[model samples]
Target: MPVVIPAAELGEFVTALLNTKIPDPDHARTVSDVLLWAARRGVDSHGVARVPRYLELLDSGEANATPELSFSGGPSGVTVLDADRAPGPIALTAAADEAVRRAQAVGIGAVGVRRTVHTGAIGYYTSRIASQGLVGIAFVAGMPNMSYPGVTGAAVATSPLSIAVPTAGSSPVLLDMATAGIALGKIAQYRNAGKTLPEGVAATADGTPTTDPALAKMPLPLGGAKGAGMSLVFELITSVLVGAPIVSSFHSDDPQGRVHRQNALILALDPAAFGDPAAFTEHVSETLAALQGLPSTGEIRYPGQNSAAIASKRAAEGIPVGPKVWGELEVAAEKLGVAVPVTPGG
Candidate 1:
């Protein structure tokens, strides 16, 4: 079904399609950026693959393209944002900026976002905040997804935690990972690609293991009990702390999107908050160099290493999106009265 269009055509096609359902041009652009960046990087799971679902959510009332967000002050270092059922990325843009600023003042900043739809990669925010030469850590907690090891049905959400530090290299040691072995986003990506997942990524509803993508009824916690325990703690700091609450009942994703909430705790610590900034940077660099200098069993990756390389390669060659996704993108573009892409670059 892939209608091969060039990259430019694809972008225009996607832009036009989003514009049709989402009247907010700015939010549409933000969504575009998130999708594009995911593809440009190596995360095919979170990349442009989600366009169809996003469009469907917009066509329905599940995800409101235009939402009026409100912000209120809490603790001096805390800000609570009520998304009023808006897209997650749009609401986060402002909240992230405010958190970094608070970090500038009190050596830490925290923002809680509630009543928003799915937010993309956690690393995106931490990386942005780290460019200010501060150590940035983000905790993204959501609703119940996977179950406790050896249990069935949904029990816990795949709470993701990410961290980033500033460095001169093209890619910093940015680490973004879910507490689970695999994330819900990645499962959806596999479904879209019509491919089976690997064993250990997920399990069937009966607690038995399966690699069938269609049987991915639950997300498995990473490192077993340890990951599950961390997710619970983050759920408290994120959703529970914000007063929105987190449980299996609150977690529902249908064509008619439910009233979901998100909590993001961004902590920024200035190097000066501890000791000399230069010394800290030098120490980190030395450690990284030592790690890289060691003989590698395979590839010595320092977090975010894979993504930076993927982005560089995609920028040069072109992103390798599924042919089916490409076809639908073209069809959507044609429907929107936009030009089709000649290649995937657009």
Candidate 2:
């Protein structure tokens, strides 16, 4: 069973919980908004369901609640953010904002963020950039939770990438994806639902393919070697470039090498810089119209179209949260002395 709660109430609850752990009110609000956005957009695996894990990390000192973030300018249009182990949403929001600013000034802008925690949905950050009428591309690297193709056990991070193109409509054309066949968070969702893992998406502790969520230890790549290779490249360009390399450090023999850190690269390109902004919008609208008009057996939807619809529906009705996630939220609320929102008819 799932409990339905109004979006406003959910956001308030999440913000309160995060405030208990995060000293900075702004950071807490940013994280709360990102989490709620994911939930409303139907990406439950990366949504409020992650609050428990975030709390655990904060309690264990793996994630910083009040980080001293610093920003430095590199070459032209390049900026680097030292998050100092801040939560991913805070760092990512800062980086995305900076990227958009720099892109407005110059033709293009790139921002790199280092020493952050788990970034929820990559699309949220990119969508912010696209909302500014600029092209946005984002990549993130974290500790390994997926296996390399033809390899055993966890050898690489799922390594998500996202691109958002400004469109004529409010919603941008967003493409957010992980290199892995499935996200590790989705695996947790499956376990919470008492459901089996999808075939070829995960492996057992010993490397054999498994459908049992409890027995699954690692996710497989999206396209075997190709996906694994892209993950490697993302790790190199983001983490390695930012000097917070996780892939090599995770495999190092040093026991202290393992750390809870993530790195991200965000790029923004202004359509006005290339040509006329109106022309760009016209082209995008026409292309999308043609694609949508194509004959198909079923409805042909764009990348973010379905998510936008889901968000609208969830906002009007309430966010439907699974029982397991609701229980976790209740536990957190109790521990933090925050009152849980009342669900309708309950």
Candidate 3:
């Protein structure tokens, strides 16, 4: 069974850990926000559950607390960022800002990023760009996971793709999805619990299908051939285009034999390029309203709607954490000796 923790306590504990271990305030803030938002949005796998790995990587020198980010502006509204081997939050934000700037200038901005760490939560970046009154689309890649297109075994990264549009009169539509049948994080959670997974979702190391979490190593594509095709195309948009430092050695060198760290591509567009921003947003709002109005045969959920609703409820109540993760955070807090926040981050 999973554990449950109060939200405020978790946030405070995480803040103390990040501030204690990572000296950079912005990096700490960004990481904290991502973790907190994950919990608030009910994505437990990504919430405080990630802290142990973050600390492990930080201690192991795989992720640096402070990485200097720099950029080169190019023709055709392009920006190339050298992450200087920094953590993802810093690099991703810098890229999003640059994309917004270029889009503002040219009605569109596209950036290719290299040498960054795990950015965590691609929606965070796209939503940031969208909030600035621009339409944004993004793709990010981690080390390779699963096989490619009936290939069964490893071929390319999981290839997560995201698109966010600025709504003039309503909330922007943000669609961020993994080509995998389910999030790899979900598999990890199941494995931790020694549970079985939903059928047809994963394969073993040998690439045969398996529902037993213990035997599962990778998730299959969501819709088989269609899923594989989308992931294949995403690889072209993310890793290859950005020059994935992938070598035969890169795979073996990584613990998972996929992502050594993280790689990403960000594309931003100004709605002004298409037409009036207000009008565009109004149309989106109307369409979404109509869709939501349709009678749900079951528990119908919109892409980002659940997150917004959960945030509202959790804010009034508290963020819930599993007991295992809370215990881990407690130990880290004791080590750092920093006061945890009075309220959890949610």
Candidate 4:
């Protein structure tokens, strides 16, 4: 069972825990906000569930707490950021801000980030850009944790992609997804819950598909070759472009190489640069209306719509933390000498 805690309390608790390692208060808050944003929207796999793993990385010196991030301007509307092993949210937020700023100056802007840690919920960064009235796109690549379509072992990173488009309404249309059939964090969630994985989603060490969570070694691509191909292209655009290719550098042979290194690319476009902003918003709203009006057996909600609704509801009620996640949080809090947020019933 999961326990419910106020969203604000959860955020405060997470920020305090992160502050223990991350010296910069703003950086710690940014990381905590990103994780809690995912949790509030029901993306539990990318949410506070990752706190324990992040703590491990920080304690082991695999992830830098206060990295001196550097940025250099490229061609018009282009920028590259050297994360210097900083946490993903910190690097990503900086890149997104720069992208939005450049987009405001020009018609479009792109930012590349290299040598960052695990980028939790790429949508969070994109949606932030969208909230600033710009179209946002983001992609991230890391060390291989997923198998290539027909390969035996892990070959490529899951490689997530996210896009967000602003609309007249409060919520933006956002699409955030991984190339793998299931995210690595979701696999960990399944293992924690003692549940069997869905068939065809993962394979055992011997290269055979397995439903047993314990036996699952690597995740399969979403649509076999199609998803694998997208992941490869993402790696090229992100890692290779940023001069930090993860797949080529890290493999099972080099376990430590997989610790805390990733690359990301973000783009922002202003609708006003192309045409009238009002026209773009009207078109998007009409398209969404048309899609909703289409014949359907169930609810027809666009991407990010349900997530927005979930976030709102959870904000009013409370964020749900599963027993396993709560237990891990407790252990982390105790180790760091921080107090955990108290649940309603407990």
Work out the TM-score per prediction: 0.88, 0.98, 0.89, 0.96
For residues 1-346, write the lDDT of model 1, one tens digit per residue: 3333334444555667777877888778777666776777778677777887787777776677888888886777888888776766676666677778888888778888777767777777777777878887888777677777655676777888989987644467788889988877778768877788877868877766677778788878888898889998888887777777766345555432234556667677777678887788778878888898998788687888789887777777666767767677767777767665565344
How good is model 2 by TM-score? Answer: 0.98
Model 4 stretches with alpha carbons more than 4 Å out: 251-259
Count of clashes in candidate 3: 13
Q: Residue 30 of candidate 4: its Cα lDDT?
A: 95
Q: How would you order the candidates by TM-score, starting with the best?
A: 2, 4, 3, 1
Q: Across residues 1-346, which tens digit of lDDT does each residue of candidate 2 receive? A: 7999999999999999999999888889999999999999999998999889889988999889889989986877998999989889999999999999999999899999998999889999999999999999999999888888677788888999999998886578999999988888899888877898889998876678899999888888898888899999999999899887888889999675677789999999999999999899889988999999999999988899899999999999999999888999999999899999988786
The per-prediction CA RMSD against the true structure, in angstroms, equals 3.4, 1.1, 3.3, 1.6
Candidate 3 lDDT, 1-346, residue by residue in tens:
3344456666666766887667887678778777787788777777788887778777777777767777875796997888876667778878898999999998999988887777777777888899998878888766667666657476555667778876655456778788888777888888877788999989887678899888888888878877777776766766667766543334466554444666678988888888987787888777887887899887755577778688778877777666567667767777778664443332
Which candidate model has the greater lDDT, 1 or 3? 3
Instruction: State model 2's lDDT.
Output: 0.91
In TM-score terms, candidate 3 sits at 0.89
Q: Please list all clashing residue pairs in model 4, or write none if there are none.
A: none
lDDT value for candidate 1? 0.74
Clashes of 4: 0
- Winning model by TM-score: 2
Q: By the lDDT metric, which is better: model 1 or model 4?
A: 4
